[model samples]
Target: MLNRLSIRSIFLPTLVGVALLASVGCQEVPVTGRNAINLVDDQDISKKAAEEFASIKKMQRASRNPAQIRIVEQIGRRLSKTVFWDVPHADWEFAVFHAPGVMNAFAMPGGKVGVFSGLIDFCENEDQLASVIAHEIAHVAARHTHEKYSQGWMLKPLGAATSIGIGTTIGGTGIYVPSVGSTAGGGVTAITQSAFDRGKELEADHIGLIYMAKAGYDPRQSLRLLQRMEEDIASKGGPTANGWLANHPSFPQRQIRINELMDEAMSHYEKGEVSRTHTVIE
Candidate 1:
């Protein structure tokens, strides 16, 4: 039978390691001020993202429409200026992909933003497009990719520790324990990671609202754009809210959260010079 000293020997170092990791990796997310773990090297992540962004640009067909290019670049320049200090390492570049039916946009680390032609066509005005761009930029600004990697690093060790503890505790007993710790740890990890991703998406929406407002886009357009998207999803029979397993919060839930932050975003919008004109996408 293992003594109390044996348990201490196993756990003490693990506890200390976790504490050291948290202390060294903790960082406050910009705009939201939430403490997040980000252990990945910034330069490495940026370099990889830049490389991937280049690959995507080469593989995907670029939009040849001058109007699409013009609007995206215009909004990109304005939002990039507003977020300069938040993402200092960003070499901001926006590209429009020629996919006319895929309503999506993405932003990578080091400030590579891409908009599918469908998303541009889907937007009713410049402000709506700006809202989506700002949301993607918020993901980069929040360092979510780095945070996700850090979380994976932490979780693997934690799961292994749980398995070890279970094995050690039952070692002397004649009872057969069937890897219960690993199974339970896996379940917990999946649930926790999904919840974390949902929280990050909501946080991005919050940060993006303020960003678009600061960049002179009407903050209310963000709400309108979400409402429209929600309606579209419902019309197409897409799941509105996928409960705990979904990475993104439902459209209605996002709108509700953004509604709470409208007053603050509107104040920023009122103070900013309204230079972003509504460009109707034809």
Candidate 2:
């Protein structure tokens, strides 16, 4: 059995190693200017994202509506150009998936964006749709996926260390402790991860609002979209924003944040060249 000195020796090196990795992995997130750790290679993540996007396209039905396709592509093209410098290596592609009643959109690394038909239909105007797309694109630009992978990589060793520490502390007492540390570590990890994810979602909103404004869409539409979504959720008896495990911030929280950033976003909008006129989606 490893003694206290042996455990200390291992723990100290592990911590030093983690610090070294963190030092090397830190990068600035675009728009938000926040330092983020991204140890994974972008090319590798992009390649995997492309493959996964392809698989999703096969599983989900693609929308055939010409107008839906047209608007998505149009807004996507504008947003892509706006974010080009931030995502310089992106090979952007946008597709609209036919999933009625499912209001969601997503962006993967390397600029793979998918918008659901329900989301498109729910949007009051083209600008609101642009808000959603811009938010997803912001996720890619901010390298959130890469950061998430890097976090997972770092968490594994920390979790192991926690288990070791717990075992060492209680093993001598001869009480049951096999799952104790692991359970506690896992709960802590989950809460930490959830908080991290929620923060990322808000960061994405911040970045995306700027992206939409720079792309000539009205940034205020994003707030309106969130309000509408919140009302719809309440009407349907869906989950509230207070859930501890939620990965995204509550709509009200998001709106508040967006409101705080509105002036800056509006400045960009005032200076940005208009790319397209508003179109009502029927």
Candidate 2, 199: how far from true, in Å? 0.7
Worst 10 residues of 2 by lDDT: 168-177
In candidate 2, stretches whose alpha carbon ends up further than 4 angstroms from where it belongs are 1-23, 157-196, 240-245
- TM-score against native, each model: 0.78, 0.80
- Quantify all predictions' global Cα lDDT against the true fold: 0.72, 0.73
lDDT of 2 by residue, 1-282 (tens): 999988876676557547847676688999999998876678977887777678667766889999999999999989999999999999999988776655666677888887777788889999999998898888889988777666555655544423321111110100001111343322222212232367888898899999999999999999988888777766755653223325567778889999999999999999968656678887
Error of 1 at 158 (Å): 11
Poorly placed runs, candidate 1 (over 4 Å) = 1-23, 157-196, 240-245
- Which 10 consecutive residues of model 1 have the lowest summed lDDT? 168-177
